[model samples]
Target: VEPYAALVLGPALLLALLGPRWWDRLLARRGKEHWDSYEALAADYLEALQGMPTLRATGAVGRVRERLERRSAALHRTTVAKLRVSLVDTGLTDLAVQGGTAAAVLVACSSAATGRTAATGTYLLLLLASECFRPVRDLSREWHAGYLGVSAADGITGLRTAEAAVPDRGTVAADWASAPEIRFEDVRFTHPGSGRPALDGVSFTAAAGRTTAVVGPSGAGKSTLLSLLLRQRDPDRGSLTVAGTATAAYTLASLRRGIAVVSQDTYLFHATIAENLRIARPAATDEQLRAAARTAGIDQEIARLPDGYATLVGERGATLSGGQRQRLALARALLADAPVLILDEATSAVDERGQARIVRELAAAGRGRTCVVVAHRLDAVRHADHIVVLDAGRVAATGDHTTLLAGGGVYASLVAAGRTAQEERAA
Candidate 1:
């Protein structure tokens, strides 16, 4: 056989070397887009599911279902296209492997017929030719398996990239045993793509072992202020400190561990009551859970349930009443035992008596910890040790209830409006 017959394997060797580069150009770009498309579709499905009740109320469920079907069909088409691209690459690889082996076999036969080698030599040549393509086949198989990971890795990176831009790292630890003063010094923040700053020149201190209430008009930046304190956001122009130490000095995990939050929208998964409470403190005992629930004014209600702590909350606590969900959130926060507690409209859904009990519980807890509140009702904050009134993203006034009421500014007007509303309701 001619030594030049070995030249037949040239194409296969070239493909083995260059195929990866080709795949990277086509497959990687498609992979990222594929993940993004799937994510968008999934988000739409979740939205549709969550709003199903509203859709039914408006007699729009069928229309929404039709839209979803259209999207599903589009997704099916996209999936088929991606599969075809993968198959094409695989087919090319198989073609090279087969063509090279066949050429080598034909040459070996020609050499044997010419008696250029004994039978043993021809058999050896055939065996050697088959094994030569094995490595390329192995690489092709590995590539097919690994392309799935490439697409999945993009989705994982996207989920994490939001907070990755700002690396919050520190070695300083928070003191869990003592309540720390949380002070915002001329803090300012503008949300991405927003035309106006959410909080501008806003400064206040939530003193240790005291209840501090933030009362504001609609859009007065109350929630944004608390988010800064929670270190969910970093202020653009100023510093926030806890216990005289800048919040950035403490590790993110430790800073968060020292604080607990109960937002207006309570989130409970589909699980037993006991399981949800344990999420706040995984090691909490049954007695501890009961105590926190009692303080949040929900223990008696649980006692009435047939399964008590074993009751399921359903999806996002949909099975329970709004008041019940809020109380459960409060109980979970209390169970966390953090030295600093943040409550945003914590009592808005509770009955009058339940609200009073929650207020009293906060007061009692204030002796050993700090409480920062974004109060829904102005009158509910009458007993707050300190009140910070915000207007137009700035501190309009700051004082205790009586002083601010007597001072006759924004806080006083808010109080008056609340009282007048109450009087109107009574009349």
Candidate 2:
């Protein structure tokens, strides 16, 4: 009877102790699968939301909403199904442990009653059975909790994987003194999923300590050309050299350290004014901060804020007017003090009075630095030492603004059109 008791009780105890580990692994596997599905659905939803403005503008919001709603409903159904399966597995595991203990107890009681086992022996057997099943029950409960944890981990992994697929440039070295001159040698680029190339065999040299303005019609690849210089995307063919070195030779961080950009869309973080300024040059002094603001013609406005430089600029600087945001962006670029500066419609948002002030300030700030300006307003580009006119993704004319205007090509027509529009508006 003693030997029989040990046989039934010892194996039952082992099953209870070991069962939980196996169940936990199974739960984790299932949870990871469910999490991957949920994350894929979530990614799709976020991508659709990002394009919400365009969808709404194009009158496709209803269709987008419907598709997202269907995805959400599917996710709900999957979550509920996983919960149901988990509940069933937990209940079955508990039943198996309890049933095994019950059988052991019955066998021990019969042995004691029949005088085949001592009362003490029966009590020990029961205690051992309970102890063995205790681990099983604890494991079942922990497995349930582990499912949630593993699911969360799986979701994070999916997000990281998706982010990894997005193209990222290599880091540039911190040394700026060895920066190379930027050159575009017959470079061409077409935006992702676009029908036509934005830039086509565009060749140009941006010499050190010189200013170049790219002038063109609305779709003439001016912005695209600048984007290539910024290394936003590599050209389809041809080579881009910086400082006598191909762009691929240096890290992206190294390449960008020598360049600063102030464009029509000036993004400001939802942070204090000082914090935003520090993004360009973390070591800038308070005096340097004030000087940059003053140079951009925004010192008076920033001074009026309740906290001065510490004032929080709301998301994307929504609290500031267009001219103020542009000036702030200029201040940020100025603080960077890179060797090359690109201003793409930097003064377009400002009023004529503000434009005049900013243009004058830029002329002074741009001394001894390479500058590239892209402007629809002829007044802005007219002062640039070299101007290149683009039409249909090609250089239609290249010369100073006066020279191009006198040549009677696309630049001349655009100037005439701009004048006519201004006169009509005045009337």
Candidate 3:
């Protein structure tokens, strides 16, 4: 009786163990497919949310929704496939348990019929068989329940590992008070997933206590050069030095603290006007804030607002006009009082008159500081002490504005185009 029971249990256990292994293989493939679909859907959803205004304006919201629905339907199909596999897996486990129990009962009945064991022994065999299969049944159920959770855990782990690669803080020491002369020597940088380099062996010098303008056409790597100087990214095959020290040698906080930037797209938190200004200097007084705003030429406008400095800017400063937002960003950078000032398309939102006024204000604010101005509008940067023209990630020419214009190279071509655009706008 024992030998017959052993044979039945052995086969049942093997089937139970191997069945889930096969199911797990199927589940793994399904999970990977599901994850791919989920990721694509999430990316599309995020893009739509971020570009909702554009989609609405272009009347493409319906198209985007249709695409999302198609993605969702595909995801549903994959999920249903996984569920089917789970159901099949459960059925296999049930078959193993039921078969083992039936076999054990037959063995017990035969023992009693042949008088090989007492009735008590038969009952004990039934009880023992139930105990043997109990753990296996529970394991199978738990594995089925945890499959989704395990896949989700893998996603979380991947996110953490990616974030861990970028350090929030640095161990290097630095000094922010010293106005550094920025230098990029034979710098080369290629953005992720791009074949061409953003900066190709680019070399230049931006002197301390002077304005150096970076002028170029679109995708000429002007922004990339600034990003490297600010240490947002390190150059792939060159050195970037500030005040004669490698940019990477400074802590992220220290490096950022040494430079202030105002760009065309000013990001303002959904907070009070004063709160937004305070992001530059958290301990600045209201009087100090007013002074900085005055220098940026936005103080009068802010004063006229219903809530004045207490007014909420709404999401990304959408409550204010484009020019107003740019001025506010300029004021914030001024309040920062860093040794270096960067104005990347800072006057892009303003009119010609406004652009000239902001230029004057910036010239005043940037006195005795290293100023890096990145712009496509040549007129705005014509008075720069030095102008660097970039073309296809290389410095096509470098000199003061007058010299570059005289050279009749890439800089001249860009300036001529800018003038044509300005004239067309006037007409």
The alpha-carbon lDDT assigned to residue 285 of candidate 3 equals: 95
Tens digits of per-residue lDDT for model 3, 18-69: 8778778888778777777888889999999989999999999999999999
lDDT of each: 0.85, 0.80, 0.86
TM-score quality measure for candidate 1: 0.87
Best by TM-score: 1
Against the true structure, whose lDDT is highest? 3
Instruction: Estimate candidate 1's RMSD in Å.
Output: 3.1
Per-residue CA lDDT of model 1 for 207-313, tens digit only, reads 98888999989999999898888777888999899999988888888888899999999999999999999999999999999999998999999999989999998
Off by over 4 Å in 2: 1-72, 114-124, 134-180, 192-195, 424-427
TM-score, each model?
A: 0.87, 0.80, 0.78
Assess the local accuracy of residue 8 in candidate 3 as a C-alpha lDDT between 0 and 100. Answer: 78
lDDT of 2 by residue, 1-427 (tens): 3667666766655665565455555566667767766777888788887788899799998888888787787778777767767776766666667777888888888889999878888998888877877767777777678777878985577787764321455544535463235677888888889999888888877666667888888999988887777767778988887666776666777667778899999999999999998899999999999988988889999999999999999988978898888989989999999988899998888876777777878888888788888999887878887888888888777888778888998989989988988799889
Winner of 1 and 3 under TM-score: 1
- The true-versus-predicted C-alpha distance at residue 151 of model 1, in Å, is 2.6
Clashing pairs in 2: 172-253, 172-254, 180-243, 181-243
Q: Candidate 3: which stretches are off by over 4 Å?
A: 1-21, 93-145, 153-155, 162-172, 190-197, 236-238
